[model samples]
Target: MELRIGNKFRLGRKIGSGAFGEIYLGTDVQSNEDVAIKFESVKTVHPQLAYESRIYRVLQSGNGIPNMKWYGKFSLKTVLMLADQMINRLEFIHSKSFLHRDIKPDNFLMSKAGKSDFGLARKYRDSSSYRHIPYRENKSLTGTPAYASLNTHLGIEQSRRDDVESLGYILMYFLKGSLPWKGLKAGNKKQKYDKISEKKVSTSIETLCEGHPIEFATYIHYCRSLRFDDKPDYAYLKRLFRDLFIREGFQFDFVFDWTVLKLPAITMPKPSTLCKCTLLILSTF
Candidate 1:
C-alpha cells in the first residue's frame, strides 16, 4: 500500500521489518531524495518508536548517526568501512549512558551505516546519581543468541563490554561467512542455550578467528577482558580494523564488494559444522 506521512514523505514498498515495526522505502517530496520510513503500531505491546525517536534526538549530532528529520524514521571494506562506522556509532551511544542491548546483523542498515532497532536499549547509568547500574546475574538472555557475548549467555548483566564483544562476533561473521557455533543439536531451548554458551566458552579466540586477521582475535580478547563496569576502548577497536584495512592496501573509495559484480563466493562452513540458533523471546517492560 502507498501512503504519505503528513503529505511530506511518500512511503513506498516495505524494505525491512522488526518485532516492533515495519520500514518502507520512502521519497522526500521536498528534496526528491530517497529515504526510509519506520512505522510502529499504537498498540504494540512495548512501544519503542517514541523512545527510539528520543535516541535519535540524542544522537542527531553524533558522527555516523542516522538522520531523523521526523519522529517516524531511522559500507564495507567495505567491511572495514562498515566496522569503523559501527564502532564510532556505538561509541557515541555508550557516551550517552545507554546500552543497545540488541546488536545483530538485522539491526544494522547497510545503505546508511547507522544503528537501528532501539527497543532493547536501556540506561546503564542513573541520570541523577550518575552511578553505573550494579552488576547482576541470572538475568534473562537478551539479544540474538548467535551474536550475544559469552557473559551475556551466562546470564551476566550486559554493559558496554557486552556490546563491544558482540561487535567482535559481528566482524568475524562478516569476514567468515558463519560462526563456529552455528550447528549444535539439543533436545529443547534450554539445552540449546547451554550448548551455545558452552561452545562460546570453549572456542578459543585463536581458533575462532583462524585464517582471519589476528586483529579480529585481538578485538575479541580485549572485549572479553573488560570488567563489567569498565569502559571499552572504542578508539583501539576501531584502529584495529582500520590498521588492517591499511595493511591490506585497500582504498577508502567507499566502494563495497557487493557493489561490484563477478566477486568470488564466500566460503561458508558446512551445515554439519556450524549452527544457527533461534532468536530469544523478549518480554514486555
Candidate 2:
C-alpha cells in the first residue's frame, strides 16, 4: 500500500530506513516546505512490541528533541514495516513510566540542512531530529546490539541508559563518520560485543576522528567515555559530557585565575620575572 504523498509535501527521494519504519521527505502542502514522513504498522501484539513501545513512550524528550506526533493508529503492511513498529514502540513506552531504552542515530533524522556537518550547517541540532518510525514496529530485542547499553546487554529492565548508549553511538557516528564497530565483523554476538566493549582495539575510530576540529573532536571524546560503562545512564553520561564540554569547548575561554584557578599569566614581566632573568644571566656567567 502507498502512503498519500500530497502536493503540499513533494517526496524528493527515499533517504533512509530503520528497523521499524521508513523515512520520507515531504513538503508542506500549504507552505511548500520540506517535512519528513514516517510510515508505521500495527499488529496484534503478544511479545516484543511491549519493549519497543515502552522505550518510545518512556523516553523523556526535552532539550531540543522533537515531540512525537502520533497519527491515527491503524494496522498496515508488515512488508517493510519496521517503521510502523517503531511508532507503536514510541507510543507504548511513553505511556508506561520509562524512557526510551534505545536512542541511536538510526532512530532519528534531521532536515537536510541540519544533516550537514556542524561547521557547514548554520547550527548542529541533533536532539530535534525527527523520528518517522512505524507503529508496533519494534520486535526482536528492544535495542540494537551495537549501541545498546550494558544494562541492555545484561538483560536488565529498560532504563534511560539504553538511550544514552545509543545517543553516544549516534553522536560518534555522525561526528567521526563510523561506529566503533563500523568495519569489524564477527561470527557471533559475543565476539562482536567483545570488540565494542574493548574500544582500545578499535584503532580506526581514533585515526578517522584525529584531525577533526575541536568541537566535533570533543563530541567523539564524549562518546568514547559513554561507551565505557556497561550500564551507562543518561544522567551520568550527561554530567560527564557536560564537564568535558566546559573544559574543552570554545565556549569556555576562561582567563587564568591566579589564585583560585591556580594558573600563571605572562602578561608583562613582573619583578619576579626580571629577577629570574637576571639570575639566569648570572648563573651562565
Candidate 3:
C-alpha cells in the first residue's frame, strides 16, 4: 500500500520502530529525495513525537547537528566528532532552558546532515531564571537503564549534570562496544534496573574504562564530579574529545566507520532535479 505523510512525502518500507512509533523510509514526492518519516498515533502512550519534532526544529540550524535528510546517515571515527556535535547540541538545548533527559547512542542519530532525536527532552525553565530545580525522589525512572546516571535511577530530578553523565556512558559505549552492565540478570524489570543502577554507582571510573582509552575514564570522572546545580564546562568536555582526536592524528572530515561499510545502492536525486515545492512542503512537515 502507498502511504503518504503531510501530503508531500510517500512512505516506503518500514525501517525501524521504538517506544514512540514506527519509522519508514520515505521520499519527497516532488523531489524524489529520501527522508525518514516517523508516525505516532495521536493516542500513543508516551506522546513524545510532538516534543521530538519541536526539538528537531529548534536544533535544525545548530552547528554540527544533522539536517532533516534521513538518507546518508554516517558514523564517526574515534567518536571525537560525535562528542563535539553532541556537546554543541546539548549546549544549545541548555541555552534554550531545556534538558535532554534521554541521551543514549540510540537517541543520537548521526548522518551527513548530524545528531537528530529529542523525544525525552523537556524545558527546565526560562533561561532568564537561573534558579535550580529541586531534586524529587518520587519521579519514576525516565531513561535507558543501562546508560542512565545514578541520579536518574534514584528518582532525583535530572539536571544538566545528569545529561553529561549519560553522555559519558554513551561515549564509553561507543569506544568499548559494550558497558559492564550489559548482561546483568534479575527477577523482574524493576530488579533489573535496580541492579544496573547499582552497577553504575558501584563500578569505579577506572574499572569502566579499563582496557579502553584512559580519556574515556577521565571524561566519566569529570562529568560525575559536577554538583547538582553546577553549570558544566562544555568547552572543557569538548576539548577532551579534541585532544583525543589530535593524539590519534585523526582529521575532522566527515568520513566515518559506516562510510567504510558495504552499503546498499542509494539513489539520491541531484540538486537540479529537486523540486522547490517538495523542499517547501518538507520544511513545513
**RMSD (Cα, Å) of candidate 1?**
14.1
Better of 1 and 3 by TM-score: 1
The residue pairs in collision within model 3 are 66-113, 66-114, 67-113, 73-111, 74-111
Give the runs in model 1 whose Cα sits over 4 Å from its true position: 1-76, 261-285
Clashes of each: 6, 38, 5
At residue 239, candidate 2 shows an lDDT of 45
Which residues of candidate 3, in runs, are more than 4 Å off? 1-76, 111-115, 261-285
lDDT of 2 by residue, 1-285 (tens): 112221122333445554434455554444555555443322212223334434535663755433332221211111012222223343333334335554543343221111111121111112445232222222334555666654455544443334444554444443333444544467887687666545534444456345433333443354445432233332433444445444433122222111111233423222221110000000000
How many clashing pairs does model 2 include? 38
lDDT (tens digit, per residue) of candidate 1 on 51-164: 776777787667766676554111225557667777888888888899998786666654334676788999999877779999999999988888999999989999999999
Candidates ranked by lDDT, best first? 1, 3, 2
Cα deviation of 249 in candidate 3 (Å)? Answer: 1.3
lDDT of 1 at 145: 84
lDDT of 1: 0.68
Candidate 3 Cα deviation (angstroms), residue 123? 2.1
